[model samples]
Target: MKFRFAMVCSSNQNRSMEAHFLLKRQGFDVSSYGTGTHVKLPGPSIREPNVYDFGTPYKQMFDELRRKDPELYKRNGILPMLKRNLSVKLAPQRWQDNAGDGSFDVVFTFEEKVFDMVIEDLHNRYQVLMKTVLVINLEVKDNHEEAAVGAKLTLDLCQKIEAAESWEESIDDIIVGFEKQHRRKLMYSISFY
Candidate 1:
């Protein structure tokens, strides 16, 4: 059976979007969510900021892809196409509410806030069938770099998952590897902070 995975990230636009595409391209059954809401209004509200950078500017990214690969542009607008292929829904509710669903075979939180929130919610829900949620703290030099790093990380992780003797036996090992890598990065950052 295809592995069911949910990827939750702080912003729906950049890193998560890239990973969503890459993971599906690797043949996993994946879904994604962005924490920020994308609201469209006819006229600008006073509260609305015109130059809002949600995650990565998807339009600019897509335009870049258009220049690089015209065929890809014709095939699909990057965000919608990724969403369509991955069955990703931009969730309105916070991660806490999302955790109660008990639908995900594996939930991978891409940000620390979402990770803690999911853990709390899962503990409350106490769902017997739910698997451990994996936290993927993708390391990159800067925010703009997350998409590239996240895509590579996801691809590598997918390869490891596929090569495993069985998902049941090695899922924890996979998670441990990701967690260790993430923590090492965190500790590395502590020096700068």
Candidate 2:
């Protein structure tokens, strides 16, 4: 069976979406979500407001930001990111709200807190189901540059996972091997975090 994957982060706008895009490009079934109360992003200025709700149209948010502060949005790469985010469906959703049908085979989280929240929520709502899911925490920073780095690591992990001949039997070994390989890669400043 093809593995179903989920990528999660605090806001779902940057890190998770980046990985979602890469994985989808690689022909995997994937979804992305946030574990925050609201979507938050950097604004044009210190005083400029930048908060949005889940499921808000990316174009709408982009347009508003562009109207409010075109320079800031453009300089910070928000415009292009927003343009890319527009294609993501079921995004910016809370983890608790998206425990959909227990279909995910694996989930990659960007931080320890998000990983904890997801595991706890899964155990509470789907105790038995949680046993079958592989949740890995890569502790990535929530930023444009960091998100790009994290996407590379996530893509590497997915490629490794996909190449395994027996997913169910070899998942543990795969994770162990991936982590070991990840540490070596990190030594070269690949920055999985």
Candidate 3:
């Protein structure tokens, strides 16, 4: 089976959306989803009850991207993965089970809160498998930096994974790298803050 990577971004609109497209562009099978449950069409989310409403212009941006970067998708091939299938459902109960489903070889959480929550749940339910999930705090200044950050992170991860002797060994190295970088960034942020 083709390797799968799931990226959970804070808001489904900008950062996560860009990450999804860029990964596909890079020839990796990736899927992205938002944190909150409620999804809307056309423009950002309205102030509807129980909705996260990230205000992502999914349709507009996607169309433009496809037109401008048609080769990015065409070269990759037809049906270049689907956003719907990769979109993860964030729920309390499914948290544990979802982490261990073996569907994803690697999982990344963009925000701190989601990282902490998902990491804890993954550890509790899948003690042995928890190491597979890498908690990355891509805490850049804003969404503008997300694309650059995501690309850099993906490159770093691919390097480590490629260097490893085996998939299992690479998985451990990737997680360690992610944690080390995350802590360093946190320290830098604390000093700046």
Candidate 2 Cα misplacement greater than 4 A, ranges = 45-49, 126-131, 184-193
| 2-93: candidate 1 lDDT, tens digit per residue | 55666666643445556766787777777665454441111133374223333334455444445655664445344344334334333222
Write the candidate numbers in order of decreasing lDDT: 2, 1, 3
What lDDT does candidate 2 reach at residue 47? 77
**Candidate 1 backbone collisions, by pair:** none
Please report the TM-score between candidate 3 and the true structure: 0.51
RMSD in angstroms, all models? 9.0, 5.1, 9.9
The whole-model C-alpha lDDT of candidate 1 against the native structure comes to: 0.51
Looking at model 1, which ten-residue stretch has the lowest summed lDDT?
184-193
Candidate closest to the true structure, highest lDDT? 2
Q: Estimate each model's TM-score.
A: 0.55, 0.85, 0.51
Where's the lowest-lDDT run of ten residues in candidate 3? Answer: 184-193
Would you list the C-alpha lDDT of every candidate in the order shown? 0.51, 0.76, 0.47
Question: Using TM-score as the measure, which candidate wins?
Answer: 2
